[model samples]
Target: MAPGLPTPKKYFVTAGAAEGSTPLNAFDNALLAARIGNVNLIRVSSILPPGTEFDPNLELPPGSLVPTAYGYIISTTPGEIISAACGVGISRESFGVIMEFSGKCTAQEARAQIENMIREAFARRGMELVDMKIEAVEHEVKRIACALAAVPLWY
Candidate 1:
């Protein structure tokens, strides 16, 4: 955690896809498409803190260690549609929950699945949903392809 930084009061969601000659390059391209390619991603579990706000245009500096909850899929099978999605459910009590999914499916399906997961998570915790955020991406593989969705927490 960065010293003197606010307690991650804002966050953002992003999704993207890309194709390349290799799996690693495809994944990097996906990250570039998602506009977080240069940062060091510190992947965390799905949980949005109390009082957290959403920012659709949030940008972190290159090489920053960003904490995120994310899902991704890579496909080498030609013509395969790989998709990823993430959903967030904000509770009236000030916290939020996140769910992520990735598989060989349409982006819409992946998004729907994550949304359902978020709803179930909130229900299990007896939390009332006050807001929601969803993001999804899909890629059809010619050689190597990757798709990813993420919720990046900011301080």
Candidate 2:
């Protein structure tokens, strides 16, 4: 790649490792969110082409979702899910994820690489590998809401 040349877009993958949503005020909740926000480097593949449209509600490449081309986005919170996948009318159990091209790789290559990476990540975390029903669609990029609201948790 030459300097000033159009480089492939980079996307970041982030998620809360605690499996599901926790009590809002719980220390684990805050810790997980912080951990998710701190992920600076992640392995991504160039799969889908840039400017691919996504579901109007599930905005991929949103500012809140670590910025990745092909990767996973886990969240127990509704906001994170919507920001990550641009998916609308989805249930909370539907984990947030997006796969865009990373470098100059084709969509297939990017998808394969990302799938493997996600599988490995799951194994390392001792979590079962569940399949995701992903669909490709054209969508416009929109401003993301990065706010993580502090929901009151009463126990």
Model 2: how far residue 108 lies from native, Å: 0.5
* lDDT tens readout by residue for model 1, 1-155: 65773457779999999997899899899999998888989888978989888888888999998888988998999999899998889987667998889999999899889888988898898888877889999888898999999989987
50-96, model 2: which lDDT tens digit per residue?
A: 33333213323212423233222223343232211211111123222
TM-score of each: 0.93, 0.28
Error (Å) of candidate 2 at residue 92 is 12
Worst 10 residues of 2 by lDDT: 146-155
Instruction: Please state the error at residue 29 of candidate 1 in Å.
Output: 0.6
- Most lDDT-accurate candidate: 1
Which portions of model 2 show Cα errors greater than 4 Å? 1-101, 133-155
Model 2, residue 86: displacement in angstroms?
A: 12
